[model samples]
Target: MSARMTDAEARERMDEITRPEKPFNRFRWTITVALLVLFFGTSLTVDISPSALLALPERTLFYLGLMFLPPDLSEVGRSFNAMVQSLGMAWIGTIIGAVLSFPLAFLAATNLASKPVVFAARQILNFFRAVPEIVFLILLLPITGLTPVTVALALGISSIGTLGKLSAEVIESIDPGPVEAAAATGGGRLQRIRWAVVPQVIPEIVALWLYRFEINIRNSAVAGAVGAGGIGTLLVREIQLLRNWATAGTALAVMVIVTLIVDTISGRVRRRIIRGPQRPVDIGADTLPPDADRDAGPDLPNDPGEAGPRTFAPI
Candidate 1:
């Protein structure tokens, strides 16, 4: 009986370790009810005339039936080519954003590190985050020839701001003790960042990268509407000709399948990152393998001493 009681106590203590305390807030329920009421009232007031409302249910059913068209297997080859192009654009854009965002993220995490240069970097990140991707596509259309490059550039630019801000937030929230330890050990600015900050945030950053890839896949399709050249152009053409059923069919199929596949893959990757090492344990302590070090590279410094490295401010 005493042993069982001790075991129960141990389990209770373990549960406490895993369960975090939630900060209480009084406004959440009130805010939710207010928003719901406002939306319900606004929707009721909107004059959705009788004919349109009556047509909606029938149209929905008709489109739902179109899903059984056996998937236009004849157009498979053409659709595959277009999908490949859009995916290529997504890949190119994601790579560009990942490459650009690394150093910028270090600069943007101004709350964790309040260097004047870092503050400036944060402002630049804010500028990029504020602009919508569609707007960038328009701006890039004239400058860069209207090819996949234009779409890729627009997606990449939009992604950089989003990724930088997210990465910065992750960096800012890290425990400062590790950073202090690294500095105390005589690690240089870059080394300190490498050993302390990047080690902690790499999993979060990789998760973000995967998530951005999924987002870019969707964005690439939308970009095709502007002659960016993908399914969007096809959808636009169908809509212009009043081929509503076909347009609806293609959209529904693509949205369901593409989203499912990307979501599944990204979820798996994110889970792997969050969980501890899935494979054999590493015994090495101080030194990293040359390959690992080479792949990751040195981390960017948060501290901007006199004359920091010249970095492009995002805007």
Candidate 2:
């Protein structure tokens, strides 16, 4: 009994010794403090004040009330027209961007191109991505004037950077097995890409293009504010020049409705594209052996002697 008690005490002590300890992470706390200080310091440098932030909600509510009161339906016709124009601009721009970026994407992909090519392609993409659509519009306005074409061109040019970058990432992530298989079959670089990479990445790339289209729509509306020929122009005219709050509110509402509808449709399509096709499971078939039928054939002459080992002459 004493030995048993000693063994139990030993086991208990072992458990205590082996148990894990949860140590306080002083380093984590130190990092958190440092980040907080940096954030506050930056906020101070930017002249961001807590008092101004606190007053924002009340001011926002007041503005909303002013905009919504007696919502004007008179501008519906013009608003709808401008909205349609914006949609057209976004569609054309996105299509153009996708077309132009498709080739650049392959060139920029590290898996497909050399370091120098990838670096140069990435720098070009970065330049376009860094410039906003509005800036593009500003620069092009002199050439294209204040037309919807200007907005479309601006949006397309800016979108190429994003689309190319994302497409390159997609290309880089494609499965190498098919590519290797193609090369094994004596395929050249282009042939390998056609037979292997394009099939695997096109669907996702297309989905990304659709997503960019949705974004471009919103951007096109904003571009219109600067007289680029969309609802935004009308919106600015009513709100800033005519001071027709009701008309401006109507235009804003129309823009929101159209944008929301496009976003919802595009989002659904993107999800479907990403999920790919669903295949039905064959539960019974899955359980069956590959040679089940052959295995079920009459037991190969239980005794080879009984069947007298049959032989056939070669044809």
Candidates' lDDT values, in order? 0.73, 0.81
Candidate 2 weakest lDDT stretch, 10 residues: 301-310
Candidate 2 residue-wise lDDT at 233: 80
Q: TM-score for model 1?
A: 0.71
Clashes of each: 0, 0
Best by TM-score: 2
> What residue runs in model 2 are displaced by over 4 Å at the alpha carbon?
1-39, 42-58, 279-315
Question: How many Å off is the CA of 196 in candidate 2?
Answer: 1.6
Candidate 1 per-residue lDDT over residues 17-57, each given as its tens digit? 86566766669978988999999998889987878888999
**Alpha carbon lDDT at 312, candidate 2:** 14
Candidate 1 residues lying further than 4 Å off, grouped into runs, are 1-50, 115-119, 242-255, 283-315
The best candidate by lDDT is 2
